[model samples]
Target: MSSARPDIVVAIDGPSGSGKSSTSRGVASRLGLRYLDTGAQFRAVTHWMLSHDVDLADPDAIAARAAEPQLQSGTDPLQPTITVDGEDVSVAIRGEAVTAAVSPVSAVPEVRARLLDLQRRIIGDGGIVVEGRDIGSVVAPDADVKVYLTADAAARAARRAAEEGGSDLAATQASLASRDQIDSGRATAPLVLADGAVHLDSTYLSLDEVIDKIVSLVP
Candidate 1:
């Protein structure tokens, strides 16, 4: 018998400030597909752990309760939303505090284990653009299309600073570098160019250009 039609999971992985979110959203919206910002899910969970007074340094403690928060991700690419325990945290999760805390929170094997199923569930019947640091490699290895978005450190920093309406460029670059180091070094599902995933560098490309490139890959 012929194998099942592969789910159209457009997995886009990238380091922080690499235009993964924008490209994924644009591609999803243009194609009328669901959008899943897996990174935002991680942020929401990390924010929950912080609010609950969980020790950020204690991986075991964090892991033991990783499933406590109810994370809900809105799939509309036009307006993807993330909430924890029914609380809207789309803005809260983007703050520097959450930014700094998310890397470690995500590094916990238990946390990944908990979110993995939820992510897959959200992608059910899978016609979606899922963006994260490891989506292609772990979350949906058989995704019909996979792209690893990236850019130079300077370019990535500038993009992030622009998003923040002008932050210190140096600081933003430093933070991105730090986050990249942590993410790449993490033992569980480290950021990587998934096997067979096409690498797209958005450093010099407009968002539309990058989105079109990904869309063209959708066969």
Candidate 2:
């Protein structure tokens, strides 16, 4: 495995279940760099909103309270952590309710602004692998290595279902489809393949293969 230069930054972006998290963490761990799951940070904020009874259907309501949650993300690839207001919510953010509502919450401009500040602070001075829907296009456009990872719809659904431990494949597929539509259509920081990013289709690749490919791309 190749060791990362201290000033290197890897920005990996893709739709949900496209192996952004796994691939990023693997690359970061193998290359001796920190990792940030930006999706999990968004999920953490969504979990907080839901817990506070924020109206999911009202974007204004969500924006009004966007900065209420104090989110802290642990950058260690091996044992990343996410906390909201000093409470650990690393696992709770992955639950069904948060998953269902994360799109709308993330779409709020206020919410994006809030998290953008946090994300940039965490990504300071590089030497980190940041994964999310917009890291390449928006968060870290000047990153040393940028990757837009993707896979076929059915393959993505199956991978997500397996990760969630027996989620119905069809249902998972529909859910991912819904998120992709929302994420791609959102006005602020919508998902897109960044210019100069290596477009990697991982439909036929193993996790290790994916990680190795990204690792080799670092300058």
Candidate 3:
């Protein structure tokens, strides 16, 4: 938090593997603020859908069932948790299958609508760091610090692969590309840098360096 700024809201938006999650959590933890990972919200919904055998390819089906899951997000930067229907799903939501379906489930207007309300409520009065594809562009456009983080596809894939226990780099790259296409091409609240947002290319930056630079931007 800056001396001149009170109840600061930090919005970090970017494509997968862009380091948005790590950066947001780091910044929030250092600043002693709450943190929210909105992508987890989408993943939680996708996990619920998969568990229920929802037809993910159909938008109408997704929209109709979007509100059925009771999504809860814990704001602890040290131990962020996402649960649905009282079940802790922090790890389950990160599975490859949930990753594959999250984009479509997130694109549904009704699903976004449902999560947007929850997002706003969680971010109320703004002492929080929020990270997701659309957080800067839609969820927290007026945030005190809006950062749109990006990296070259190769770097992004490498980071993701490393995080996923040294998975195949080529396959990870392709998956990231596919996710970028779906997330950016969607008609509603597409992934984008919000107006006045600071764009940081983290392709060569260390996570702490990114966090340091953003923390410096506060005042």
TM-score for all predictions? 0.96, 0.98, 0.97
**What is the C-alpha local distance difference test score of each model?**
0.90, 0.94, 0.92
Taking all chains together, the TM-score of candidate 2 against the true structure is 0.98
Give, for candidate 1, the lowest lDDT window spanning 10 residues.
1-10
Ranking by TM-score: 2, 3, 1
Candidate 1 lDDT by residue in tens digits, 136-159:
999999999999999999999999
Q: Which residue runs does candidate 3 get wrong by more than 4 Å? A: 1-6
Q: In candidate 1, which residue ranges exceed 4 Å CA deviation?
A: 1-6
Identify the runs in model 2 with alpha carbons over 4 angstroms from their true place. none
- lDDT tens digits, residue span 1-219, model 3: 433244899888999999999999999888888999999999999999999999999999988899899999999999999899999999998888998899999899999999999999999988898999888788888888889999999999999999999999999999999999999999999998789899999999999999999898875
Give the CA lDDT, 0 to 100, for residue 65 in model 1: 92
Model 2 is weakest, by summed lDDT over 10 consecutive residues, at 1-10
Q: Quote the lDDT for 98 in model 2.
A: 94
Q: Tens digit of lDDT per residue, candidate 2, span 159-197?
A: 999989989999999999999999999999999999999
